[model samples]
Target: MTRFGSRIFWCFVTAAMIFSVISAAFPTKAEAITFTPNFTISSEAAVMINLDKDVTVYEKNPNKKMYPASLTKIMTALIVLDNVEDLDNTVYEAPLVVFDELYGQGASSVGIERGEEVTVTDLMYSLLLKSACESAGILAYHVGGESISNFVDMMNEKAKEIGCTGTHFVNPHGLYDPDQYTNAADMALIAQYAVENYPKFVEIATATEYDMQPTNYHEAGWAHIYHTNSMLNRSSSYYYQYAKGIKTGTLDESGRNLITMGSRDGNNYLLVTMGSPMYDADGNAVYLHYEDHKNLYEWAFENFEYKQLLQAGIEITELQVKFGESSDFVRLVTADNYSCMWLSTVDTNRLKETINVDPSLLNDDGTVTAPVAKGQKFGTYTLTLSGEEICTVDLVAQDDVTLSALAYNFDKAKQFTSSIWFKAALIITAVLVILYIIIVAASKKKRKKYRRVKKRRKF
Candidate 1:
């Protein structure tokens, strides 16, 4: 081979290397694909939401209204914690009429006898952990000024205040009533509010067992009261390691319901499952509600993770600037850091970001003007997954762009001189001036010729 052949071969190799580098730097847009986990649950309505991010992770029939059963006690307990001044000092006696109504309806009880003296603290434990219908009545009767109906009204009002749109309570015990119903979404929100506001609620709900102290009726004390939520008990087969304090509900008409909060790796999730099948085919009662919760928590903890998608002060994109002092463009970044729960296995390339720029900040030529201040919000970027928007972040200037007086004046002058109207006027003025000079010179020369002709004729 000649020397020229060797040079050509090296040039080809260099060209290939450059092409490879460019391809790696800016890859082609990947097809948008979302990872949807294949998980099945027995509950008719179920929902899971991230407590920290306040975003829905998974949902099915979340807005469908269903019977909440004993889950009503969650709101009942919340109101008691808010209005009741003292939990240990306040004492109330169980009324015979309350027991009569509860017993006739075949409601569950913590064995509160008529005229039995009990403190508010014991009743709360019984109300939440044991799902005692009578304990709820006593608390309501004492705190609601001897009217359980008024207490129910407060529960409904509190539900509305907590952003519950599909919930209404007719009784504190969550007894079956057509008017008393709540959806899975509403119940999850109610549980979230309860856990965030009252720490005692979580303590009582998560307890595996609580001993009721000595009361007037039972001098020795009530037997060891166990939590009705099976997930909290380690001995139970449905026990979940990450299960936290929440409430459960069951009724012949409503089947089984459960509201649960689980924490793993410093992340908390709220789950609600309603209307699970009460019985299997063999005429045996099945705890499908607990099973549903366990499945969801396990799947979520295994697959999802908290991810920081946008960080403050990190450049996201560059915007071209007109009449800028330091540079021709400026970097735009998020105003605040945003983190959300997302599937850990999902490819980050599939996440879509769309920037919506403010028209006032952009010129007609698709460039921004100078004098942009640092931290000024100029646009918004919406992050989406599978065509659904998850979050929106503000796009702010990463650095301050000072106004350049020299550049500004030069731009103004150049704009004026380059205008079509200015050029047309200048051409018209030049043409008029040239025509005047030519006409004046011609007239003077003709006059001179005429004078010379007159002199020749006289000679």
Candidate 2:
């Protein structure tokens, strides 16, 4: 072959190799369509979170405060689990005062009478399975050292400890009180804490029914206390196979509320719905909470899948550097891999990424100091869909950047020379020099005139 032909062949071969490498590193991402649940959300506040991935997929007024109703029992149960050491063996006696207060307020009851003795296990089942407000009172009264008020205080403290900002409890039973309220987001946090910390809570809340056997409070064991959440009952029309144990709440003032967990095909989620319509337009009972939770779960399961939206050590953006060893730009990347359950139909590119560089990262001149470590976190970037936030990832240095001593010293010297104090000193020194020169010139002129006058006199 001719030399010219050989050169062309080699150039084409090299170009092909480079293109292949670039293509492999960044394979083309297939576009996906964004999906929103087609069904209407009747509840005023609702939020659904993926437990395994730790991300929220759906939210409507998640942080708005609303009545939690019996959902407050989840926190009440959490406090009980923490205080009570034995669930079955530690028996408590129902106080006459507790009975009086519950009856006076018309709170739900598990048929406990004054001076009745019951085990902690029985009370836990009653609180969770039976929605037994009286059981809540008994446990609180006992655990709180014969003071229901003190137990309510503990509940508020626990809610704060669990990172619930919008939750405040004036009573343990979750009956309507103007001051006692929580938002869907806050309720989700409380529920997640209970499910993760107390397995016993889940076991009881998930039960279809519990047999309240013969105790001093009850002569007949046939008083079957059933779970208030219909999702757990197989015979109920709202029964969902993926649904598991949690809690529910209802009140004329608060409407209907529900906190439910669903796990299907290894994906687990918690959904909280509050302030749904209690009655249909015709004034009959409405169960929109159940319908809303079930439909949202199915929609999420069908449309969502875990996707790796960001990779570690990949340069996301660059920031100005003042004392860099070689270049004036420092590249930043996320320290850890970022992945979330995203709508399967939505294009990954549609996910909005917003970079928030630290305001302090740059000086007035808009440059950061050098010597940045390989994995130092500089700031963070948040991922969102439409307006809803998914997660925040720490933006870190992609590679180590050594400080240049010479450049740093030079910059400091420049800064010092340009300072106001230095300029003021320089101006004063210049004025002094000018004054000294003028004084010396005046003295010389006077001496010269004196010499001239003396010479004229001699002549």
Candidate 3:
């Protein structure tokens, strides 16, 4: 072949290779879709979190302060679950068990009279399902200590331990205490821990009906009992299918409060709503707590779909070393797979990836030494969508790049190739040049493909 022809042929081949590299490095932009969840509640704050991805799917004033009401029972339940070994231990409900201020109150009750004996299991049911103020008092007084104040302190300490920064427990039962408060986000986090960590707690909280059998003190046991979280039994309720165990609260000051969990197809969500009005116009009552939860769940299911954009441990690029043992380059890989939510017909072309590393990483002689261990982090590869940073992964050494002592020294000893290290660095730098060429070629091909597809459609 003629000299000019050979040069042109090599140039064409190089250009094609560069184009492929660029195309692979930069992906098209992913579309951004707006998520609108329909929710109506007078609640002061609420949040919905997707357990699997650990992302908030919906939130409204999630950080606002609201009286937790009986939802405080959730923290109580968590503390008990953490400390108690015997779920069926027995206890007596004496006059001492009743709070002087709460006994005559119209709040939900376990119907425990003075001198009533019951099991710890029964107290839990009453405290959680019935939101019985008396039951909570009994548990607090007995489990925490003789002093109810001490128990209240324990509750406060537990609240802090479980990461409820916004929560303060002045009492066990979530009766509205001016000092008692918790935010929706903190409650959701607490509820998530309960469902995810304590299996027994989850079972008890979700129970729709319980048989309150009589103990030695009360001859006839209460036959069929209902749950305080009314959403569990309401068949027409959208939350019924996904609703797990949690507590509900209602007070004139705090309004209707709920901390609920819902699981669908193995994906769980922690839903919390506080300060919702239970009564609507005309004095009719509604379960707006569950309504808010349903909207958040529906929004997550409708809008979020996960897709993998890059495979984990795939060699993305290679960098040559100026003063390495071998003239070859080192391969770079992604630390993990890229899985993200994106809209349909998203323009992936706008997706951008950049590799970053320390300038001094190359040897003083300007080359990289081999024997790089697998999983060793060299730099970071960041992927951005629409100029918004989304995923950043470490650029790891795909395999060991070991340099022979002779190769290192010869390149070092000889001033040949502008300091063997620099020469080696220049080689790695060559990879970046190759990347640039690939990107340009890939752009042309993509443009050509789009044009051809468009022209064909016209035909």
**Number of backbone collisions per candidate, in order?**
0, 3, 34
Question: Which of candidates 1 and 2 is the stronger one according to TM-score?
Answer: 1
Arrange candidates, best lDDT first: 1, 2, 3
Kindly indicate the candidate among 2 and 3 with the higher lDDT.
2
User: Where is model 2 more than 4 Å wrong at Cα?
Assistant: 1-36, 217-220, 315-336, 351-459
Model 3 agreement with the true structure over 1-459: per-residue lDDT tens digits: 234444544453443332110111222223322233544655778877767776665678878888888988877777777667787866646456455758566767877776777877888888788888887887777777666778888888877777877888888888778899889888888888788788888888888878876787666656457787766776554436667667888988988888777766666677788888878887997767677666666666565666677778988777665434444577889877777654334565767888776445655664455655567666777777666676777777777666566764554334434545445545655666677778889999999999999999999
lDDT of 1 by residue, 313-371 (tens): 87778888877889888898877777767788777688798877776667789787777
lDDT of prediction 2: 0.80
RMSD for each of the candidates: 13.0, 15.3, 20.8
> Which candidate has the highest TM-score of all?
1
lDDT of 1: 0.81
Ranking by TM-score: 1, 2, 3
* Candidate 3 global TM-score: 0.70
Badly placed stretches (over 4 Å) of model 3 are: 1-43, 52-61, 82-84, 103-105, 221-223, 235-239, 277-286, 302-309, 317-320, 338-354, 362-376, 384-390, 399-459
Give residue 425's error in model 2 in angstroms.
23
Q: Name the 10 consecutive residues with the lowest summed lDDT in model 2.
A: 19-28
Off by over 4 Å in 1: 1-37, 49-56, 264-267, 281-283, 401-420, 431-459
Tens digits of lDDT, candidate 2, 188-265: 888888878888888888787888756775776747888888988889999888988788888998899988899988
Itemize residue pairs with steric clashes in candidate 2.
Answer: 32-347, 33-345, 33-346
